[model samples]
Target: MKNIIKRNPNTMPKPVGEYSHVTVIPRNSELYTFSGQIGNDLEGNIPVSHKEQVENTFKNIERALLSENLRAEHIVKVNIWSVEEINWDHFDNVWHSFFETNPSMTIAYISALGLPEIGIEIEILAAKPSE
Candidate 1:
């Protein structure tokens, strides 16, 4: 059985999805944490737009999740980083296309990504109940 977990927030807009903005799992569940994923495609070329980068990053996370027979819905926390502050509108469009709901998020603006063409990176933490 799966559960929805919501974390603390005060006087802010409610999340636009069925999921809580954050989630907590019991200690018994199996946990998985992924390294930060950048915008580079499998060929090692980065995409030109923020939307493209975000899409690629999400795909990468999905691939990782599949390896464990989990899905994006299992994600408990997400940290997003961008070379410049993300434009929320652009991000929202990209986000909605891929994720049916938003997971818990922490977003940051950074001076640079390790690669010049990279615009975004996403790190994820997820859990699934042990069989």
Candidate 2:
């Protein structure tokens, strides 16, 4: 985490969400790009409510990081796509529970996903300096 730098330049307006405008990854770092994760349980059951799906999506992100022996701090960027209108209040709670520090992020509202049952999906880019 110390190897990465997150910046919000004075030239630009402050970010609307809890995220940095720019992230700098150090040279010689190992980067990992994960596929977009959806809100499904191990059994592939997606919740009906958008709030529940949002929560589950973060849980899945955690699992993805753990799979590579990485944690939230290793995350450099997050990209989110949602079919439903996001409830920021509920979404923030779930987001804060996972990431203690801000990361570069992008979120977009779209008409639909690959499946109707999926309300949201998140993909992340993570990096760590090679030991």
Candidate 3:
């Protein structure tokens, strides 16, 4: 995280949520781009409720990060897409539990995701300095 730079410029309006507007990764860092993660568990079970799905999605994301030897601090950007309205309160609660340094993020409400049962999907870009 010390290698990453987060900025919110005075020229732009304040962000409405717990995220920065820009993120800069360290030079020669190893970057990871993940596929959008849904609420499916390791057993491939997708939850029915949006809240449950949201929680599961983050769990999956954590697993994904760990697979690459990365942690929340290594994240530089996040993108969220939802078919249903996001519960910001619950979302922020879950988000805060994972991220300490605010990361650049974007969210969009869409008609649908990869599957009808999927209410939300999240993807991330992460960077860590190369040894």
Q: Tell me model 2's lDDT, rounded to 2 decimals.
A: 0.92
Give the candidate number with the greatest lDDT.
Answer: 3
Error of 2 at 45 (Å): 0.3
Clashes of each: 0, 0, 0
lDDT of 1 by residue, 1-131 (tens): 65545464666678653335547786578888889988778897787988788878877887888988988777888887888767778777767776665678877789887777888898998888655
Could you give candidate 2's per-residue lDDT for residues 1-131 as a string of tens digits?
24788889999999999899999988889899999999998899998999988888899999999999999988999999999899999999998889888899999999999998999999999998776
Per-residue C-alpha lDDT of model 3 across residues 18-126, encoded as one tens digit per residue: 9999898878899999999999988999989999999999999999999999999899999999998988899999999999888999999999898899999999999
Q: Which scores better on lDDT, 1 or 2? A: 2
| TM-score quality measure for candidate 3 | 0.95
> How accurate locally is residue 121 in candidate 2, as Cα lDDT from 0 to 100?
96
Candidates 1 and 3: which is better by TM-score? Answer: 3
TM-score between model 2 and native: 0.95
RMSD, candidate 1, Å: 3.0
Write the candidate numbers in order of decreasing TM-score.
2, 3, 1
Error of 3 at 90 (Å): 0.5
